[model samples]
Structures are given as C-alpha cells and as structure tokens.
Target: MKKVFGILFVAGMVAFASCTSATEATEDAAAAVDSAATAVDSAATAVVDSAATVVDSAAAAVK
Candidate 1:
C-alpha cells in the first residue's frame, strides 16, 4: 500500500513538473503531502478507536 502511494506521489510529481510551473508544483506537492498525512492520521485514529470499542465490549460481556 505504501509502495503504491509512493509510486502515485512520484507519478504525480513527474506529471506536475512536466505541465506546471515550479511554484505551482511545489504548492501542489505540499498540499498533497499534507492531505496524505491527514488521511493516515485519520485512519490510524479509526483503527485505535475500533480496537478500544471491541475491547470495551468484550469486557462488558465478561462482567
């Protein structure tokens, strides 16, 4: 998955570099990195939240 993401990022960079100005490419790359980071954080948060919920439910069932 990470490899795929890296490939996509690199592909996007190449495409942007070919088509747009450096300043625009830089801005877009930065924005894409930020968006990807946020998405990872949200996915991690969701996984943690889901695990906690499962654990809580198990504990409740035991009691």
Candidate 2:
C-alpha cells in the first residue's frame, strides 16, 4: 500500500510539472508574437514618415 501511494504521488507531481512548463512555453510564444508585431508596426510607421518627408521636399522644390 505504501509503495502504491508513493508511485501515485510521484506521478501526480510529474503531471503538475509538465502542465506548468507547457503553460510557460505558451506564454513565451505569445510574448514573442506580440514583440514581433510591435516591431513591424514601428517599421511601417518609419517608412510612412520618410515618404511624407520626401513628398514635402519635392513640393517645396517645385514651388
């Protein structure tokens, strides 16, 4: 009976640890995706700003 209980306890702990590790991995993946999205957004904004500056310079030169 003692051996049986010990086996069950170890199994339960292993299951808990696996679940926790999986949860952490999922959270890390989501964070990485968010970071990538932020970087893309920043890059797009910079491109738009640079284009506007170019257009303005062209207009000034025309005048």
Candidate 3:
C-alpha cells in the first residue's frame, strides 16, 4: 500500500512539473511575440519620422 501511494505521489509530481514547464514555455512565446511587435512598431515610427524629415528638407530646398 505504501509503495503504491509513493508511486502515485511521484507520478502526480511529474505531471505537475510538466504542466509548469509548458506554461512557462507559453509565457515565453507570448513575451517574444510582444517584443517583436514592439520592434516592428518602433521601426515603423522611424520610417514615418524619416519620411517627414525628407519632406521638410525638400520644402526647404524649394523655398
């Protein structure tokens, strides 16, 4: 009886550990996606700013 109980406890612990690992992996993936989105947003903002600067320079040259 004791041996069966011990085996069950160990099995339960292993199952919980695997679930925790999977949760952590999912969180990590979400974080990576968020980071990538931030990078893309920043790059898009930079492009817009650069285009504005070019337009301003052209206007100045024309004036």
Candidate 4:
C-alpha cells in the first residue's frame, strides 16, 4: 500500500508540472499576439498620418 501511494504521488507531481508548462506556453503565445496587434495598429496610424500630410500639401499647392 505504501509503495502504491508513493507511486501515485510521484505521478501526480509529474502531471501537475506538465500542466504548468503548457499554461505558461499558452500565456506567452497570447502575449506575442497582443504585441503584434499593437505593432499593426501603430503602422496603420503612421500610414494615415502620411496620407493626410500629402493631401494637405496638395491642397496648399492648389490654393
């Protein structure tokens, strides 16, 4: 009975460790996705600003 209990305890520990690693990997992936989204938003804003500048310059020239 004692040997069986020890074996079970070790198995449980191993299971828990594996689950923790998986959870960490999932969190890291989510963080990476969020970072990429932020980068995309920033790039889009820069493009819009550049376009606006060009339009303003053209309007001034026409005036």
Candidate 5:
C-alpha cells in the first residue's frame, strides 16, 4: 500500500509539471506570433509610403 501511494504521488507531480510547461509554451508562441504580425504591418506601411513618394517624384519630373 505504501509503494502504491508513493507511485501515485510521483505521478501527480509529473502531471502537474507537464500542464504548466505546456501552458507556458502556448503563451510564448502567441507572443511570438503577435510580434511578427506587428513587424509585417509596419513593413507594409513603409512600402505604401515609398510607392507614393516614387509616384510624386515621377509626376514632378514630367511637369
């Protein structure tokens, strides 16, 4: 009976560790995705502004 109890206790602790680690991994993944999305959005805005500037320069040259 004592051996069974010890085994059960160890199993419970292992299960808890797995749950916490998984949750932390999920949170980390979400943060990385959010950071990447922000970077992409900023890049898109920069490209649009650059395109507009090019168009303006061309028009001025034509005039």
Candidate 6:
C-alpha cells in the first residue's frame, strides 16, 4: 500500500508539471502571433504612404 501511494504521488507531480509547461508554450505562441500581426500592419501603412507620395508628385508634374 505504501508503494502504491508513492507511485501515485509521483505520477500526479509529473502530470501537473506537464500541464504547466503546455500552458506556457501556448502563451508564448500567442505572443509571437501578435508580434507578427503588428509587423504586417506597419508594412501596409508604409506602402500606402508611398502610394500617396507618388500621387502627389504626379499632380505637381502636371501643374
């Protein structure tokens, strides 16, 4: 009975540790995804700004 209790205790500890690590991994992945989205937004804004500048230059040339 003592041996059985010891084995169960060890198994429970391992399960709890695994669950904690899995949760941390999920959080890290979410953070990385958010960072990637911000980079994409910045790039899109730069492209739009460049297009507006080109349009302004063409208008000035016509004048």
Clashes of 6: 0
Count of clashes in candidate 4: 0
Weakest 10 consecutive residues of candidate 2 by summed lDDT: 17-26
Per-residue lDDT tens digits for candidate 1, residues 1-63, read 999999999999999889765797899999999999999999999999999999999999999
Q: Give candidate 4's TM-score.
A: 0.63
- lDDT, candidate 5, 1-63, per-residue tens: 999999999999999988765777889999999999999999999999999999999999999
Stretch of 10 with least lDDT, candidate 5: 17-26
TM-score of each: 0.58, 0.62, 0.59, 0.63, 0.59, 0.60
Q: Is candidate 3 or candidate 6 better by TM-score?
A: 6
Best by TM-score: 4
lDDT of 6 by residue, 1-63 (tens): 999999999999999988765777899999999999999999999999999999999999999
| Candidates' RMSD to native | 15.8, 5.4, 5.4, 4.8, 5.0, 5.0
Write candidate 4's Cα lDDT for 1-63 as tens digits. 999999999999999988765777889999999999999999999999999999999999999
Scored by lDDT, model 4 comes in at 0.96
- Name the runs in model 3 displaced over 4 angstroms: 1-21
18 in model 6: Cα distance from truth in Å? 8.1
The clash count for each model shown is: 0, 0, 0, 0, 0, 0
Of 2 and 6, the candidate ahead on TM-score is 2
Task: Estimate the TM-score for candidate 3.
Answer: 0.59
Q: Report the lDDT tens digits of candidate 2 across residue range 1-63.
A: 999999999999999988765777889999999999999999999999999999999999999
Candidate 6 to truth, TM:
0.60
Give, for candidate 1, the lowest lDDT window spanning 10 residues: 16-25
- Model 1, position 51, has a per-residue lDDT of 100
TM-score of 5: 0.59
